[model samples]
Target: MANGWAPDGAVQDQIDDTVKDAVLRARGMMPSGDGSDECDDCGEDIPAARRAALPGTRRCVACQAKRDATLRSVGINRRGSKDSQLR
Candidate 1:
């Protein structure tokens, strides 16, 4: 069932797109290091515990937190194209 004047599958497609976008965003946010226990951003020694908790972590926890905050502010785009129109 469509809501308002939207098509039947529009809402579902939006949901799927939102999920995909989130997955992509998460992948991009992932650390891309070789578990060196070195902070890629500041070149400081990363703690062993931190390395274990977040494998492949490139940035320090503080830097990563700051980056995450910036990402949250941008929000996500939900435009629907024909490719997205298929649901």
Candidate 2:
């Protein structure tokens, strides 16, 4: 049963929505159009393998890893208090 008066599939719907949001966010982050031969950040040459694998990759592995590391973490409060949800 769902907590409080939420509908039968509310919990599952929340989970599905969270996954969908993450997928959309990832897709938005993906490179579009043609990839360059050089890393956008460091100007180092992007490997052919990465360009082929990702299709539109631009940054080298190291630069990309650094950029990924700099991204802020997003947390879902699955266990948020009912009072918190009310606000």
By lDDT, the best candidate is 2
Stretches of model 2 off by over 4 angstroms after superposition = 75-87
Which residue pairs collide in model 1, if any? none
- lDDT of the structure predicted as candidate 2: 0.87
lDDT of each: 0.76, 0.87
**Please, what are the lDDT tens digits per residue for candidate 2 over residues 30-70?**
98999999998899988888999998888999999999999
Model 1 spans > 4 angstroms off: 72-87
Q: How high a TM-score does candidate 2 get?
A: 0.83
Minimum summed lDDT over a 10-residue window in model 1 is located at: 72-81
* Superposition error at 17 for model 1 (Å): 1.2
* Candidate 2 residue 79 C-alpha distance from true site, Å: 5.9
Candidate 1 residue-wise lDDT, 8-51, digit = tens: 99879888988888788878877665877666677888888888
State the lDDT at 17 in candidate 1.
82
lDDT of 1: 0.76
